[model samples]
Target chain A: MFTAPLVVAYPYKRTVGTLLSRFFQSLQEGRLEGTKGSDGRVYFPPAEFDPVTGRQLDEWVTLAETGTVVTWAWQSAPQPDQPLERPFAWALITLDGADVPLLHAVDAGDMARIRTGSRVKVRWADERSGGIRDIACFDLLEGAS
Target chain B: MARRDVAIVATAQRPNEVGSTLTSVELILPVINDVIAKVGIERQKIGFWCHGSCDYMSGQPFSFVAAVDAIGAWPPIVESHVEGDGALALYEAWVKIQTGECDVALVFSNGKTTSGPIDRILNLQADPYMVTPLWPGFDSLAALQARACLDAGVLSEADMAEVAARSYRDALNNPIAYAKENVTAEQLLARPYTTAPLRAHDCGVPVDGANAIILAAGDAARSLAERPAWIRGIDHRIDTQRLGARSMTESSSAAIAAAKAGVGDDRIDIAELHAPYTHQEILLRRAMNLGEGTHVNPSGGALVSNPAMAAGLARFAEAAESVFSGSADRVLAHCTSGPMLQQNLVCVMEGE
Candidate 1:
């Protein structure tokens, strides 16, 4: 006797628009810039408006790519379209010129080696197609030594 | 300036299911019309209209827009929608009423859990940049909080089972509820864990359904309800999305909302709470400051049937039902959002 198979489904798609779309467009062009919020704070991935004071963020500036990982969480299984396809570390990297921690994927697969103070570098995707996914993945800065 | 009052004059809800074989308009029309007909209020008289829903749930955007057509909104009666619960829509309408903007308003919502992997769909709500990439689905996140609470001595696994036992048993009396039963804390604990420290029963079932509530102010409200559940106060607030920044065991926003709404000193006869997770119910109970004497979840609460967008509003609707039935007078209603009780809304209802 033969049995019918059961099927299961889940969505792995996301839509990008508005402020985030503009922010990613800049990232795709190799220009990492931030807008100054009403609080006089330069927030990266420019908010539509200052979340605190509700003022428009119009001023822009480019930021250095180097940063230190503040805290890290290891993804045993990465989600679809994420920069890292296998088990890897996602860190909160505060770029040298930025005031807040920026989220990005670290190419390090072994989480036990990744720590709060571990140093990493961005490996910007060679062919930028105008999206946040353009950054692809970052690698351990072994050559930075 | 005196604080004006508003009450839930009429409420209606559909049964809970994992998936509904209905479109948004098909899902909402009957429930919306049912509430409107119950109160006999003309749709044109309604001042402001707002609803709550999430596109992430159905793998589509602006799903709530079609649900509006059931109201025949071609004339464009004032309206808006939040990516949240219909309870928040109720909160928005109440705020407008306090502003003396409109005399009557309608709030509603509907959600289908079976449209996709409901657990994974909730991941979109997490920190997309970091945490969500890890795929720590809702069950895992709740288990994380459950771990924190248990280790911190806030609640034990046994305590969670006890909550499940009570919620499921109570649901038996509720005809519209999805998961009803014959079970106890001991029996619940014996089941294997879905996530360590969290059993299947510990979480609210993902139910698909629709709900709507009618709100009238002052004289117009009195006409719809013999005992217009006057909304003495309604307030809501949100905290930073960083789950690690705040204690998961407490609902700070809900506490602030309760303080703003003046939850104390009144004889709150009944309380309807919306805590999708059992542990959240514990946190919300503390946040709302509802005394032990107050009856909570008389409609069996979310543990029995959690229909996402409609679930929260259904909570307030349940409380209003108690008021309409003359089973209780002053009532406290609560709605929650985000992981644990990160975001909260509270409303106080009173009879004439």
Candidate 2:
């Protein structure tokens, strides 16, 4: 097969907003929380305003980091500036405090064994100052006492 | 007046440069005036003003607000902006004319790809949590789709090269085109691949430029010209952004829009298609039900020059301009966004 040129796009700095700024800041302080919205959806990232009801959320609570991996896709070739240097799986992890799962990378070694309903724990990066990559990738909690 | 007979009266665009070292609202300011001057219409006569641009593209919010100053939008004109493509903005203005609310409207799109690596900026549109953090960038993600297309046998490397040859050949007639006097498709294939199954020819030249299209309705449209090209129909549709879940080869959104816009009955004399990539043009042509009788992308299509949000509207403008000049009686136009036309819009125009 012949080869051809391709064009691609990457990420640039985007604004997270005041409310999300606080939420992300708190997460960096070794804290975890979910904010309840009037629309009845508990958002882990903390919604500045309810998308459904158009109401603001001021309340929050600390939640457990343990969650089950609902589904995942293995990123065998990590792109530049990604959190992990090696192969990882992008997973929708349902943290204990939130009803819905949050998407994050998992340290799942291989795609074949990263099955549904895998229990995982947040492996916080040594440097955390609030951002999605703060968790880096979740580690398998299988043998942890 | 009923105001349903809105037509694109004038169109103007500047050359698309990779980084656009040019500055301010003035970058493409000269071209805007040139287009308006060709129509012999003053800018103040335009009743409605609208623009489509993305904040993420500029890496800042309300990036279009500054471009508005170029329009000299003072004393506060009725205006709006979309965070998406400029063609959608033109569609919004076109819809306003059809509704009898506004008689004339102006639309444009602008971006500076040189300010940052544009691929990184485009990732903001992806599934933020999972796909975005992985940072595949825009090309690799599209390459994944291109690879899928190859596996499905829906397209071949040479076919893309052929598309490039045909487009560049057509673009030779267009002075504003970016890909000018390029070599054969086989030679394009010989060039190294940027992503597997895709090449530089497969992608639109990254350009930073601004363009404006003006519209007129009913009597206002009539006064604007002796033979006005009227917008007969317009519609758009979007598919969910799950690349893994959706059909990889077909553009369902464009199909839905083509049906909604009543494309089946009209005789497409000339058609302009916005296919940022070569294979997508094939998908969109099938989706729009375009036939051999119809001239597809005589303006060299997006393969020649794409002003991001502006490319789609340029497709519409090109279709209308062809008819306006008495080259064709009826025409079809298609605009696309996302990988493989994840979102699509169709507009049919006819000359009186």
Q: Model 2 — TM-score against the truth?
A: 0.73
Candidate 1 regions with alpha-carbon error over 4 angstroms: A1-145, B74-76
A102-130 in candidate 1: lDDT tens per residue? 55678786756666666676678889876
Q: State the lDDT of candidate 1 residue by residue for B1-352, as single tens digits.
A: 6767677899999888765767788888899899889988668888888888887775666777777787787666899898988888888888788899898999988888766667777777886643565455666566556665765678888888887888898899898999998799999999976655567898888889889999987788878888877788778888756554455567788899988877885868888888777777777777777777987787779888988777889988889888888889888888888765768888888877
lDDT by residue (B259-329, candidate 2, tens digit) is 88878886688888888888777777777888989888888888887767678877877887787789999
Question: How good is the docking of model 2, as DockQ?
Answer: 0.10
Evaluating just chain A, the predictions reach TM-scores of: 0.76, 0.81
Error of 2 at B25 (Å): 0.7
- The number of the candidate with the highest TM-score is 1
Q: Highest lDDT, which number?
A: 1
Candidate lDDT values, in order: 0.76, 0.73
Worst 10 residues of 1 chain B by lDDT: B127-136
CAPRI classification of candidate 2: incorrect
